[model samples]
Target: MVAIRIEFDDDEQYERLKKLKKHRGLTWKGLLLEGEKRVLEQTPE
Candidate 1:
């Protein structure tokens, strides 16, 4: 698997994401892994 780094410039967006992570009780890595899993599930095989 390839790893990529992404940056977000909007402070509001960043804060919202932080809030989501806290609310969901997920670490950054866990949140990203969940996102990847969701994307893969939605894609056609």
Candidate 2:
């Protein structure tokens, strides 16, 4: 697996994502995996 650093243009967006993770009861790694899953699901096979 590759490590990546994603920067958000707005601090509110970053904070919102943090809140989402907390609300979903997911760790940082889990949040990343969930995001990856969503991306893959949206992509064409």
Candidate 3:
């Protein structure tokens, strides 16, 4: 598995992701994986 790192310059964006993880009942890692899946599903192979 590959690891990805993302940095946010704005506190609001970071807070939003944290809120989303809480709302979706997922950890940060899980939230990233969920986002990856969603993006990949929409991408053309």
Q: What would the TM-scores of all predictions be?
A: 0.80, 0.71, 0.79
For candidate 3, the per-residue lDDT at 24 reads 97
- Residue-wise C-alpha lDDT for candidate 1, range 1-45, written one tens digit per residue: 867786888999889988999999998888898899999999999
Stretches off by above 4 angstroms in model 2 are 1-6
Better of 1 and 2 by lDDT: 2
TM-score of 3: 0.79
Best by lDDT: 2
Residue-level lDDT tens digits of model 2 in 1-45: 988788898999999999999999998789999999999999999
How much is 28 displaced in model 2, in angstroms?
A: 1.1
Q: Mind giving the per-residue lDDT tens digits that candidate 3 earns over 9-39?
A: 7999999988999999998899988989999
**RMSD versus native structure for model 3:** 2.3
> Candidate 2 versus the native: TM-score?
0.71
Supply the TM-score for candidate 1. Answer: 0.80
lDDT of all predictions = 0.89, 0.93, 0.92
Position 38, candidate 3: lDDT: 99
